[model samples]
Target chain A: MPKASSGLLSRSLAVYFKDLRLELRTKSGLNAIMMFGVTTLAVVSFALGQSGLSPKVLSALFWIIMFFSAMSGLAQTFIREEETGTSLILNLTAEPNSIYIGKLLFNLTLLITMTTIITPMFFVFTDASTDNILPFLVVLGLGVFGLVAATTLVAAIISKASVKGALFAVVSFPILMVLLMVLVGATEKIFDNESLSAVSSELQFLIAYVVVMTTISLLLFKFVWRE
Target chain B: MWYKLVLFVLMSIMIYFSFALPAPQQQIGESSRIFYYHIPQAWICVIAFAMSMFYSIMYLRKKEIKYDDKAAIAAKLGFIFCVLATVTGAMFAKVTWGMYWNWDPRQTSIFILLLIYGAYFALRGAIEVEEKKAALSAVYSIFAFVTVPFLIFIVPRMVPSLHPNDSIISEDLKFNIEGAISLVFFSALALFTVVYIWLFNIGVRVQLLMRKQLEEEDF
Candidate 1:
């Protein structure tokens, strides 16, 4: 074992690798999330006939997929440990910040994979047009950061609960509603071919949301992490 | 206690003012009366949530089991008041705007607040382990409150809202309170705060008793 003073990054990375290895072997979280994301996209695209979706509605539809898919899977990081009776082992082995960061990174990877597939498929299926590609990705990046930053700790909180799955959405939607609304607005601006400056305000809000949420999660993780 | 009588009399006076006072002419029509009930319900709802958050912080800081009881009860009462606000606000919307669920910024924000607190209770109900439930939920309560400002203030400003700006903060709301209505409004505010505290005290007592009973059961 490494010295306890190996620093937060190394400790966190140790946790990250542990979970990543387990995840690769099990593939449960990724499969559930991807299945939900793609299935939602397929059903919605077929129902809406893949056209006539204004930028506004298309933006909303895209996020609704991301949101529900996230709802389906993001809690699994903490949930998996609890279900496998490894929560206390993780708690004892890792610093709380390390565990939190590790889980957050795991969630980030899942979200990135899901969004990468869903965004292109959504654009093709819904024919959602974007006038500015770069700003859209920036907003998407900020959006995912803020969403997982808030939910990672919340996922830890709900992991102990009996009603884990539904409770995650109930808790998360309120916190993420502000970010989602901003993303939709930013997406609308991007579709209108607005310049980066036009998207700056939404980007700013997303940045603020991410910072505030991350600070709170870092501060409170110890309380939620241990029994 | 004398405080209970004070609440009762003050509540009666507020009701009288809500109905007996002349309605505003320009916008609300007879529906202006709803404000007397609606605003206080929403304000108390906010007060209850704030109180819950405060106690949750206290629980974390002190690690006192008592703080958990107080926090849980405050959140429960707050959630109830929030529902009352949404329902009354909807009724007011139906009368004034001719629709029940308009997704006005104020309405949407409160709905979000409702969901947040609902999750708090759902969380409490889901965890059977006593100490773990208290610790985790207290942390969750504090974390969840970070969004309250954005949902209530920033989001409202960003969206084009059909709900008027609160009369207390901005004159930009559909109708401004002046003269007699102002007196009634302030009185209702005072009455509601007192009533909220009174109910909160009862709630803490009841939660403590329930906790004691559960402990005895375990023995």
Candidate 2:
């Protein structure tokens, strides 16, 4: 990979292209994420009795699927790189900040796309009606951003652990608190017929969290990746 | 080590103030004395987590094992402060709420924090390799600290509570000599921080010494 200027967006785009092409050929990451999302929703619905899946409940369900689904997807982000011995290759060629942003963008894409596909399936199966789907989507969208940034950093750390999959949750559970709280709070408003304006504060919080977390991740990626 | 004297001086000052600091204008009398320990411990807990997260990130960026050691020390200190906070809060609850553990939001949140950090140390001990241990521990510390705000801020809002709701300063509850009270609190925070630093330095040196001893044996 040729080195690009330090503009995060451009670097992220480049790395995204690289991962996208690899993903397109393999389709492994996409297939795995979607499968995890659908399966998780199915299990949750079956266990909880689909009758309880109201629109408000669906909103909460939507973020839960994204969370756990993205978790499984991200668990392997750095692991796959390391397993293939390409982590060092990629790290050597790309700056740490670029790698962090690139991974973050890619993870966000994975989470959002999976949520989009799985959410309608949830509505269809559970017969839930979301009054204002836009707010729900926006809340989920902001949440996915926080998830990607937070999980990406964690995924980097757990990739070096002896137990990658199990440790990912241990590492991410704490960091996911704010996003989960905001997601649940904003999602519950769907039941009460509140305006999107109510969720604006949470969305702002998510955005601030994303900025702070990603910056820290960017600075720390180089050290963690050194291994 | 020099800060030990400062800690003693601050401790004496706090003790002196504890006697004179009037009770809040409400029902509580001598029970309010718990605020000095309870509030400062909460502050220290937050500070310790912040230090752990900062050092964790530094460890990842610099690939310095020292940062990992520092993070671990910070986390241990944070855990200790959290325990003290929980105990003092429980003591306060026993006096004010007529129960030691009411499952209040603050109590529950502190328990959650304890679990998270407890799991952190457990995870560190389970991992064997030097590099892998540092990396995994750093990741956990970062994530766990990131979650602290949620435990501190959001969990409390999840349910109603008798614990005084979040307020930096309450007008209704006034300390006539507020400046002196703040100085007392600030001194306690600084004292705890210095003690933490001293302990952390000792921990790092001990670990280094052990590593050197292991290397000699290997040779």
Candidate 3:
């Protein structure tokens, strides 16, 4: 028999794969998030009409699209568990930390898929363009991870609650506010084609935000997961 | 009961010194008086939040109802003072900066703090099961307080803040603080802390009463 430590990685991976399989079967989480992203992008670009938009506006708009899109569906990760009556069985099988890691991975995958589809569409539809792809992607990557770490735990909390709708945004906005602020600042620099030196501080802040959020969530998840 | 008398005395002293004794500084003029209320309210907000998180950790470790009750009351008071800080700070900003809402990084950070605890209450209100409500909110309080340091300290440094009141409760360290003003400030802080304790005890009593009534009804 494999010891728990020996199987920890594979255990989490198995949970992740299980989520992936379920996601492939229904794709509801993917569809809702993507549709919201694309539709919001279309509306925003249509309203602006490709004229004299500033770097700050473009950067802010990009996150608003991504942020709202995320809010639309991320809670469904744990909500699905409750709704489907599988949470109890899943609860009995995997360690709480492993379950949390799996749910976080699943949420992150859904976010990535939605962003991948919406990101280029954002630049295409809107007049926003970034000259520095690498730094922008770096910020985007960290920002997404921060959002995932922050929101995934929040999603878990709300999943158990009766009122899920507004609470997610209320709880998540505070944690994400710093992340979104730095991302917008970094993205504005990317828009202006500024050197990495320009966005270095914001990037560092994002890295810190990510580390702090994930650490806190990991510590608190054990309490949140169990009865 | 004796602590209540002490709270009353502290409140009276805090009022007199804050309203009458402290010398108003130049540049900002008379409006600077807002600093007394603003600073204490913000401190209460921070301290109360810390207390909530402490109780949250306690709840998680002990799984006790009383710990959850302590956590809940602390957070609720924290949220109340968070709003007070925001409003009082907004008024202060209006006088100093010519607008009520400057989106100062400090203001924005406080705004974020408000939302975090607001979500805490919302989470509490959502669950019908008593134990689940307590446990989930305790967990969330811990999660939310984790961001307070980032919001209050790191965010301001990251952004070039125009807020004159950037210091997080550095009122004592100010060179501008005369002995009189220092007396007032410390007294106000003591008063606010007592007020918090008073409110916290009241909240716990009410919670206990509610639980008792529920038990009686079940019987």
In terms of lDDT, which candidate is strongest? 1
Docking class of 1: medium
Q: How far in Å is the alpha carbon of A17 misplaced in model 2?
A: 3.1
What is the per-residue lDDT of model 2 for residues B149-170, given as tens digits with 9 covering 90 to 100?
A: 6556655664333245334124
- lDDT value for candidate 1? 0.84
Per-residue lDDT of model 1, residues A105-222, tens digit only: 9899989988898889888988788768888899888888887998899898888888888888987877888788888888877887888997776777788889999989999999
All candidates: TM-score? 0.93, 0.78, 0.94
Q: Which runs of model 1 end up more than 4 angstroms from their true locations?
A: B24-27, B161-179, B215-219
Best by DockQ: 3
Instruction: For model 2, name the residue pairs that clash.
Output: A223-B60
Instruction: Estimate, for each residue in A105-124, the C-alpha lDDT of model 3 and write its tens digit.
Output: 88999998888888888887
Collision pairs in model 1: none
- Stretches off by above 4 angstroms in model 3 are A1-6, B161-175
Worst 10 residues of 1 chain B by lDDT: B165-174
Error in Å for residue A47 of model 2: 3.0
Candidate 3: clashing pairs of residues: none
| DockQ score, prediction 1 | 0.73
User: Candidate 2 vs candidate 3: which has greater lDDT?
Assistant: 3
Q: Please, what are the lDDT tens digits per residue for candidate 2 over residues A1-227?
A: 54565577787678777877777888788888899888988887787765765555666776788777887787665777878989877876777777777777777777778877987887777666667778877776777778888878778777766667777776577567556756776777765677888767667777777787877677657666775
